[model samples]
Target: MAQAGGRIRIGISGWTYAPWRGVFYPKGLRRKDELSYAARQVTSIEINGTFYGQQKPQNFAAWGAAVPEDFVFSVKAPRFLTHIRRLREVETPLANFLAGGLLSLGPKLGPILWQLPPSFRFDAEGMARFLDLLPQDTEEAARLARRHDDRLKGRAVLETDACRPLRHAIEIRHESFRDIRFVDMLRARGVALVCADTVSWPRLMDATADFMYCRLHGSEELYASGYNDAALDDWARRCRAWASGREPGDAERVGPRGARVPRDVYVYFDNDLKVRAPADARSLMGRLKLLAADGTPRR
Candidate 1:
């Protein structure tokens, strides 16, 4: 089908999973070809490895080259900043992460997900300061990367292609982030509040930015359960509404409603256990008319 409304991308969180190898991945497929294979079935993917430690520039380049020109990869920000520092005194760590070759993804880079630990409560001042340190565009990111300490001397990639807008999203697991002030702060900085659906997370649906980031980690179970037809039908409805610049009347919001404007929507299935992530992702894409029954783009 031809392009319509705001963009809607449905995909899995990460491409590599042992359980997904013989299941999601074709039997006998080489491990090295997994990313390219998954990219063809989904519109986007969230790179989870980047969250653990620094990734080589060559790795980023190879990953970028593996996907189609239109495919996008949302990189999870380092946990050292969120888990270890708890968003405090993270200027240098954030800079080091920026210097860690994400720029090599270039056009394939999507939102940067900064997922706070469940123990990290909402602190207005601390969150505000941390948000300020994030670069709004690729050029600004390169400038920040230039400030990296001696840690990234040899492996850092501080260069970027032509300037392009960069987006950031925060996935809060603690209930303290329910404060309207937190939502307002995110809105002011244009950072998206990730709508993470899980059995335990807060699952806030506030529209704090121009685009929406959603992670369906399984409603009844954290990462093992699958979404039945009825559940996915509901999600498809909400995705369409959000893409058309509207939120469900009953949406759980911490702050006032945002202005009506077209919004791009990115949804990733993080329920990777039992190989449900890719299955649900492809199903959602099919519901959105993005993919056909035969794994081809809708025509």
Candidate 2:
């Protein structure tokens, strides 16, 4: 919440995991209270469920109300649009997705993530066209929602409380996306290039938009590993640099330096197999002074 740097939100990728049941969620805690409990520990959460299928308006409303007012949720775009459609002829699908009640999250919604398939390579024209289809604000999203297909005829939400900016971030897996031109395209489109930490994929840190989105999916063993003290420390430092509106000096960037101005940042830990995500998230939050030493929020 410091003015020197824009809002920096640290959290786990998702909240529902059986392994996390007594580890992240307290023992004997009711299933419904899991989200509330997790929200108290971290400032934000990445809802990965949306990537699988369309959710009802009430589902989003309940989720938004379950968390604190200061908490936010970054949703994963449905795979029907990103995987099956592969950024081709997605206007209706995109509209259907937006119509599926994302606006129901209201002020609690953050960025929408589009994670490309690993085998999917980069195509400048296709990406540009896809980016052009993204709604820039909630009003545009509501308008787009009005065009939803019959699949959501009964469940569509086509209204908004007020106009607000909508942000998008893309996570690329193929090596072809390592090109600087791709970075430039994202920068031009005002979409954040997800800085994904993986063992094989191209891990880029090029700051393209007014905000940064990062996914820590384990450096050694993919989703099965945990970030040690040293790894967490390095990530915290890089996050601080990003929050200050400057790329880390050691960032493996594909493009040149971007504009220097305070920027908001979102970092989510996806290594949840062993229940290390929540712990790692809290550690990073503590390092950034968002959480006190005793696992309580600082401000």
The predictions' CA RMSDs to the true structure, in order, are 1.4, 1.1
Q: Mind giving the per-residue lDDT tens digits that candidate 1 earns over 154-238?
A: 8999999879999999999999999999999899999999999999999888999989999999999898889999989989988
What TM-score do all the candidates reach, one by one?
A: 0.97, 0.97
Worst 10 residues of 1 by lDDT: 1-10
- Each prediction's Cα lDDT score? 0.89, 0.90
Tens digits of per-residue lDDT for model 2, 19-57: 999777889999999988999899889998899998888
Instruction: List candidate 2 segments past 4 Å from native.
Output: none
